[model samples]
Target: YEVNQNSGNENENGNGNRNDEATIHKSGNRRTLHTTRGCTNKEFLNCQPLNLKGTEGAVGLAHWFEKMEFVIHFSNCVVECQVMYATYTLLGDELTWWNSHVRTVGHEIAYEMTWKSLMKMMTEASCSRSKIKKLEIELWNLTVKARPKMLQKAMELANSLMDQKVRAYVARQADNKRRMDNNPKDNYVHPGRDNILTVTLSRKEQRKLLRVEPWT
Candidate 1:
């Protein structure tokens, strides 16, 4: 009877040991998962994007938007979180406008808004027609200033091409002269045997030759 009881006690102890090992494994996995979450949270905070104020003109707004998008992409934020993080960085007039917008739209709809829609609303509210016109005029002036350089480069390319064509024409003429020098009998096919044509025909004579005169 004592031997039987001892064997049963050993079986219970073995089962408890296995349960403890499984519990420890589950806890370790949970800790690792939590640590990973904490690390990502730190990363998101470290990579926070630039802020915006409503008073910043078109150029400043454009710069902020570019930086913001870069940070958002690096941070790997989802659509809903993107709006929250972007609006969190707003200051001064921009914050005031955001609050007004939220009050008008209500909390549920405002919080659910996409990042793109928020940007569009902000642009419409912030960038006035005068600022847009100013930006356009500046861009046009830059284009105008760049025109002379572009034209000069184009002219240089065209001149280089013309020079190449001229060089090719001169080389062909030289080759013809060399061939004539090598084969002197080729010139005997001229109008008369006594008339030794010294050089190529002029453009005027060539044109005249092309024109068929009526028989007198």
Candidate 2:
């Protein structure tokens, strides 16, 4: 497949600066970036191929467009090279259609065509307006049906979290009470049951408990 600047003025103007940077050329599954013609100073080992056949429908076309855009950005593909490389990835019927399109439009006109124009043409060819509208309606219906359940699930999760926090607080308070009970400082006589004793023991009681006799 051949891509020409026939698409738009934007590509031509962009080519002035972009071409100065790098041009990505595919070699097998990998792509290499060349700053100058016939130079292979930098290589990208992880570059994936952008193979898109015409039969993929609207969803597939959107996926392919996303992938192509990612590849273009990742490879830093120049404007002309972007159109050329992306078109080259088209397979089977898509390739045939593009070739026929190029021939009908003439190479000079097709060569000047921008990437945006090609995308518009491809989208129109792959998806009909009625089909797109049907898809939108289906998506809207699905979302509406699922929204209430989703909200209910969210509320249940929030209430569960609050219950866990409450339990944790109660457990912490219980643990603190246990610790206080085990401490000797908290072993005071109960004022309601025992003889009148303030929160603290008298000095005599303290000495008696320690088994130390008071001096005269």
Candidate 3:
């Protein structure tokens, strides 16, 4: 289906496939929707809201997610290679820092980051708005600069929590595989080249944060 989108006219081709095109026009008393080669998603999201009647669909964010998950349950190195192991592990480390600061006493870590709601914000929502994505990056940069002084305590908590989360996730995957192996007749979706399963340090960390993660 191909829709002019601008004129609210719908056009369709014989075969069932989408032939969509989006455009933006501003200034002058004229309007046009053009498919240009230099357009980018960031630019698309940054566009201002249009008061035009049919322009909303053209400039609006497609509030949808790729239902596919990226985590694979195999022991093979292929699955491991696809994931951003160091980066994601580092994120877990940060979460660990927060947990320890709250629980530990005399050896308490008092990192004063204003983004305590960060993890929760990510877990609860996923939107196509560019502003939110930009805000997240801004918050992260702030956190880096506002990091706590007690490096030893921070590292200790981070590493411990990260390891536990990874191990537990792997164990769950292995158990699921064993169940599928035993019940051959049961329908099971095996990890494949096209399959995408999301993975993270515990369920808390898995989110559609800033775009899809490397592995996903």
By lDDT, the best candidate is: 2
lDDT of 1: 0.70
Q: For model 2, how does the per-residue alpha-carbon lDDT over 66-123 read when each residue is reduced to its tens digit?
A: 9878876776655666666778778987898889988898877876778788899888
- Give the true-structure RMSD of model 3: 38.9
TM-score of each: 0.41, 0.40, 0.19
**TM-score, cand. 3 vs. native:** 0.19
Deviation in Å, model 3, residue 92 alpha carbon: 48
RMSD (Cα, Å) for all candidates, in order, is 21.0, 20.3, 38.9
Q: Which residue pairs in candidate 1 have backbone atoms (N, alpha carbon, C) closer than 3 angstroms, thus clashing? A: none
CA lDDT of each prediction against the hidden true structure: 0.70, 0.71, 0.40
**What is the per-residue lDDT of model 1 for residues 48-113, given as tens digits with 9 covering 90 to 100?**
667787666878888888887887788866565777777888999889888988999898899798
Worst 10-residue lDDT window for candidate 2 reads 36-45
What TM-score does structure 1 among the candidates reach? Answer: 0.41
**Residue 36 local lDDT, model 2:** 39
